[model samples]
Target chain A: MSHPSPRRTRDPARKQAAILAAARAVFAERGYENATIREIARRAGVTHGLVVLHFSTKEQLFVAATTPDPESLFKGVLDDDVTKLPERIAASFVHRMEASDGADPVIALIRSAAGDQQAAKALLQTLQQTAVDGYARVLDIPDLATRVNMMGAHLIGVAFSRYVLADGPVAAMSPDELIARLTTTIRTILFD
Target chain B: MSHPSPRRTRDPARKQAAILAAARAVFAERGYENATIREIARRAGVTHGLVVLHFSTKEQLFVAATTPDPESLFKGVLDDDVTKLPERIAASFVHRMEASDGADPVIALIRSAAGDQQAAKALLQTLQQTAVDGYARVLDIPDLATRVNMMGAHLIGVAFSRYVLADGPVAAMSPDELIARLTTTIRTILFD
Candidate 1:
């Protein structure tokens, strides 16, 4: 086979990045049932076939585009100092959610899940597998699962109120205030 | 003018009740945007004009169907015993949420809000006007607004996790257990 040029190799990667970005926008805007592959491909400036080639199905594409790598996400927050975990976790969550470059995937999942029971189940599964389980392993505490569940529930609530609902005092809070408040509440859930 | 028959007076009340019930079912099943006035009328076995005559608009009908009388709701929970407020509030919320007769109106609001920003705003406004403000006035604590926001956020999160997402340890929790757990959390938020 002829040697591939550098441009040829770079084209696939560039095309994929474009497609993923477009997918996130479409999914966030229209949710699951309303979102279409044609729209995503058109927005990405790629052929629909290329999108299908890269990700065989819409579900696969949605999962790939919306899911932050769990390993990296957990590693960043799951530091050795148990005393500081609450602050680190709360700050990290607030920062990721407030990131302006891309839509927050968890919020997108929640919006979509609101109308779709299947999506809601998938979101819960994703959170359990990624957040709750990760926390359980890291935190040395009794009833770890229940504690993690409460912690996850509170964070999810703050997210729904602050990001999804986007109103009320919770939504009006400055990021630092939100982080500080959440850290205190999270610590209570974990330790108190 | 001739006195109207008793049946004529009762007909309007009965028709209004039917329409409200049907509206609730349709809104819960199809969400806010997807629900149709015609469908609600059909389910109620009435003409579309009747639904409009009673409520004037789908928005009004939605508010009628999903909103419990806030006065009655608050009266039940906002008792004089400040020490028991956490338990009373938590238990009241869990009971109303677990009511099997009609759909939980708050959950309906939340689900509908997920797909619609305007609906989300309305939810926040309703909660702020009803739950947060009511709690603030009764709790008699410093920074009551912020504390109520935190309490509301945690409760909303629990609702989403248990009622909406419907999985995990939170979902599996018995009503008594949930109420107990929530009372502790709410008390901490309110007092500690």
Candidate 2:
């Protein structure tokens, strides 16, 4: 086989990050339906073969791009005691949004996955497996399953509508205002 | 040209709705990126020329498909006083989800619209404009623009995540449960 390209062979870590970043941009711009491995490779300044060799598939690349880094969206909270449930849960949700830097590319990914079943199976499960569990640990309700799910739905729906749809004044509000209002709602539901 | 299609020449209302339904399905399935008038016509069981005769263009057909007819999402609310705010707002959101019956095609439309300027502008603005005006009128807040926009973002975000993503248990909850939990949260911010 031909030797790996010299530029790529020199810096594997940088190449990996470049591929991930490129995947995010292309996925955001084109949505999963239209985004292609070739486009991502082109955006990353890498060859088609490199993408396949690195990520192995477009689905895998997208999963890597969006599957929220569990540590990033919910790291410290998991270790905290149960009594701090409401604040921790609220902080976790807020952290995810803040970590995203308001770009909310994950929203684009979830929306794309909505149109594609396999993609949906991957992207839509993050909350069920991650967020719900995090909240469950804190709430410790016997019916934790239902309550966490409800609150999760509300938070997810509200965030998507306000930020992604840019519906009315929500999209225009300062992030601080949003945090205040949403944190109140979230705190009430989780703590009360 | 050949004789006009019977639906076009004799039954404008039937033909118009048929085209709109077809457009909605096409936008929902193929999304804006790949949707074409030709495909919409084929789905509608009409000739391409017939689609043009009614909608003039796919963009027009798309707007016509999502455009609120009786008013916008908020028309009914604006007609009444502020007391009906909670139920009306909840109903507005629930109605859209119920009408779509959980298979939200609008998600695909919003996702595909990220790159299409005209489609994005029309769809996003319609979502924001009507709800802002309606929701703002009901609440006590004097600065409607900032508060409404922020709340709108939360609404769309939560709805998309819940309804479109079908985020497992979250989406499975009954409308009554959702309204119970979310309505209180909404009231806290809007009424208080």
Task: Name the best candidate (by lDDT).
Answer: 1
Candidate 2 per-residue C-alpha lDDT over A1-192 given as tens digits, one digit per residue, 9 for 90 to 100: 366553455577878888888877777666677789988888777899989998897788887886666666667666556555555556666656656644354555544643565675576676457766666554566767666655665565555555444454555565666666666666555655
CAPRI accuracy category, model 2? acceptable
Query: Considering summed lDDT, which 10 consecutive residues are worst modelled in model 1 chain B?
Result: B1-10
Q: What is the interface RMSD of each candidate, in Å?
A: 1.6, 3.5
Clashes (backbone N, CA, C under 3 Å), per candidate, total 0, 24
lDDT of 1 by residue, A141-191 (tens): 877888788888898788877877777788888999989888888887888
- DockQ, per model, reads 0.61, 0.40
lDDT comparing candidate 1 with the true structure:
0.77
- Report the Cα lDDT for candidate 2: 0.63
- Cα misplacement distance, residue A186 of candidate 2 (Å): 1.7
For model 1, residues B1-192, the per-residue Cα lDDT tens digits are 376533243377877887888888887777776789999988887889988988997787887787667786776788778899999989999987887332667576656765556755665567656776678667777778878878888987888788876788999989999998898888888887
Off by over 4 Å in 2: A1-14, A75-105, A143-168, B1-9, B71-84, B101-114, B135-140, B145-151
